[model samples]
Target chain A: MKRAFGVMNQHKVMNDQDVRRALARISHEILERNKGTDDLIMVGLYTRGVTIAQRLSENIQKFEGTIVPVESLDISLYRDDVQLRIAQPIKPTTLAADISGMKVVLVDDVLFTGRSIRASMDSLQDFGRAKEIQLAVLVDRGHRELPLRADYVGKNIPTSLEEQVRVRLIETDGTDDVVIVRSGDGNNSNG
Target chain B: MTLLLSGLGMVITLMVDVESNVIGSQNVNAAGTNRKHILDVDVLSEDEILNILDQTDAMSEVLRRDIKKVPALRGRVIVTLFYEASTRTRISFEEAGKILSADVINMSSSGSSVDKGESLLNTGLTLQAMGVDVIVVRHPYSGAPNLLAKHLPKVSIINAGDGLHAHPTQALLDAYTVRSKLGSLKGLKIVIVGDVLHSRVARSAIWAFTKLGAEIVLSGPNTLMPVGLNLVDGRANVLPPVSVQPDLDDAIRGADVVMALRLQNERQNGGYLPSLREYIRRWQITKDRLSSASKEVLVMHPGPMNEGIEISTEVAHGGRSLIEEQVTNGVALRMALLYQVSAGGYQIEEEHPNGQ
Candidate 1:
């Protein structure tokens, strides 16, 4: 509802080079803040979050020569907006390593209203208590509905209410880019 | 959770002194089985079957987790009110309920008040009074689950198996196992051998697989095959394109899956077949007969297998056999069914805009 709606035109904000640089800087910041990767675990949200986590883990491995474990979590059942969807199919949540008493970083592709992160926090309650939990995102689009913030952010983009922020990874979408597509008020999309 | 358990306590207290045979026969309209209760596979649409299979795949993931449990049906109470003795279906339902953190209570007709003349309707009302969320019932009569569902309006009823009528859950797990082994259920030729007439498993399997687009060939003796099941209300009863084949080799040729059902000893005494020896010679599923089928064909059997009668021991315990996997999938399938029925407003139906 912000402006003219164009479905065909997509404004690209980040390319492959920008994504790589952002991930490398985030890895350095994580190591510096945590004072080395001791008892560290990376958990990725399902779909795009998992791919971003693998990229971050690989970057950390290259920088510190330490292999970090990455797990994928599907928070479909924990989402507060489940009643609003057509169907809620709870996907697989594979955690190869237990996160008890460990420093865990939750990763996702795009962070908007932060409801998904909130759902992830609720889901984490059953997987044992983590000593510390942190949030990381590739794109932090402004307009968070929740009182939550990401500790590690790749890009901060200010967006209007009618705009949709989509993060596409090569593994899933066969592309590495972030775009903002404006839509009309006739169509309503969820974050 | 405590409140539900306390309510269960109230149900136990309400049943003080009673004992008699009370499985009264009521006039249940055949069409009454079309309610939300999965009494038989005939009531299910193809989309519903696919949806259940998808949900079963999701439930299977819980088995791989360290917790191995979920709170999807927490605070919900499910009673496995089984009239017949069944170790697999009962234990699997209990396990499924426990994994979903549902308060599960096992009630058998043997030691229960049903032996003391407590009717099915009264027993259902008693459980409904205690706020039971769902009841998984297996009775010796054909439409027993439908009867319980008709009497109890508040609780969901799942038919574990009701006489020769339907075992929808068993059919579901079998479909899941086949979908897991093969990529899809569409256009696959499945040969169901042995007793089809008395098998609730075969009836439900035929209804389920046909809905999922699988071509079914019912292979057995003329006396042992189901009659009057070809059509219902002028439409194909168990879905169309189902053919009846008496020759074992012709029926199994080019088949992707061969399901050998358990041969009932009662069939022999009823004059349906000559003897176990003649039945094995004519219809037993051996590896040699399976040579005409696909090399990667799967062999399945609903358990308590008559090793040498319906299926040879080697084929039942062969590499391509998914009998054990079917049993494992049973727990997960039941978990999905229980979660779908117990969790209010969850998927598996046309969602009401009012969210009832």
Candidate 2:
């Protein structure tokens, strides 16, 4: 799928196998942190985040023999920069499982600036009160604007302001790779 | 020369961006574009209608939440300027505005300055002066909302129902309801039965459904069909074929959606129709009549329904009926419209100093 922004030349940071291994490790880490996935419900931010959450749930199922419920979270309305962008089409936020008194794990693809995660956190309040909230991300690029950190991370690629980090999943983009895009080369091909 | 021109272009882009930010902070429409007035379905293209419905779908999810409210329109003032008596349309608009955390005030013609023979133009001007950001209008006369739009260009005007002209939101909600049930409107046969002559709902529905690629069959008695009804077409030929099927049974045949319009009791006294008894006998949407329609055909009614008059009670409350769903979607659809109107604008705790 096409990334939202313009891309220049791309460098593969993680391939298909690398993504699978990272997710498996993250799932294990989540189970370890939460003490075996009981009362754990996973909520994925829209687009790629939901897919990552599903993958984490499947891994949890495989390891703990427990089905972790996953729900999609759409934070388009809750974004702070809503007035700066062109009309943000509202997306469906579906949570079939109640998060009340359960440990809610928020999953996403690449965490940069942490604005989307912040908005997701604000939106999660309306669903129900979770016992605790945890953030899980596939890649954590260090540009934290809101003093937020993910509890789980797949990989951390250091990047500058001019670079764009994109995590492509097989379900959405028909490819499984994490790439860093450097600008000005005009290599604008989609991920 | 190329380098110099590119440098100039960058400077111009920066200037424009800065200019837009300064002005955008004043008017909400600066960030996004949405027409201030929605007087008719023709104002929205097929894509625009579809987008609003898509937004409505998202808004529907908000209804499912524990706290079914949003701060999207907080501090905005929405006035339901209703000239005619209404339950669904007025309450729906009010609920929608409240759901978005907007300060909504209600104004009906009966108890308001309108009863004193104050002109609509004057009433609209007064409301505009009162810092009303948007006016959801439902007037007995057709084109009242259009007049409000023409006179009050600053305040957003939404046509709730204006005489026989249009009930655009009803159409939108109905279309949303239909699409939710049938999945897609394209190539679907929608038979609109009863009182098409006097229904703004029917007119608006035709405009909306036709634009979305549904074939329309208008079914009613000759007296109840609009004059020059044959001329009815999608605003810009953005619609599929529209035909009049006087016979209700034939109209419903192979139909994917069977929409029953409310039969006005006033039409009987007006001599536009012979009698309510005769009308119901000939046109009531019974189970047997609907049997000829597609097996999975959906039923609908814009309510305050003369249940046994235009539609059989069973059919109105039947499993195939989307009547209640339409009411629910009505709130979401209006909320979507309000959100769209306020999209580019900044939310404020107080009225804009320059608000008209």
| Best candidate according to DockQ | 2
TM-score of each: 0.76, 0.82
User: What lDDT, from 0 to 1, does candidate 1 have?
Assistant: 0.77
What digit string (tens of lDDT, one per residue) describes model 2 on residues B45-140? 687789899999999998878788767777789999888889999999999999987899999888888889999999999999988889999887
Best by TM-score: 2
Per-candidate alpha-carbon RMSD to the true structure = 11.9, 12.4
Residue B117 C-alpha lDDT in model 1: 99
Q: Give candidate 1 misplaced runs (Cα > 4 Å).
A: A1-27, A35-39, A58-69, A77-87, A97-102, A109-132, A138-150, A153-191, B1-36, B43-47, B147-151, B230-238, B344-356
Model 1 Cα lDDT, one tens digit per residue, A47-156: 78888899989999999999888899987656664323433555678865367798989998888888889878877877888999999898888788999999999999
* Count of backbone collisions within predicted model 1: 5
lDDT minimum window of 10 residues, candidate 2 chain A = A182-191
What is the per-candidate TM-score for chain B?
A: 0.84, 0.84
Scored against the true structure, residue B11 in model 2 reaches a CA lDDT of: 12
**Model 1's TM-score against the true structure:** 0.76
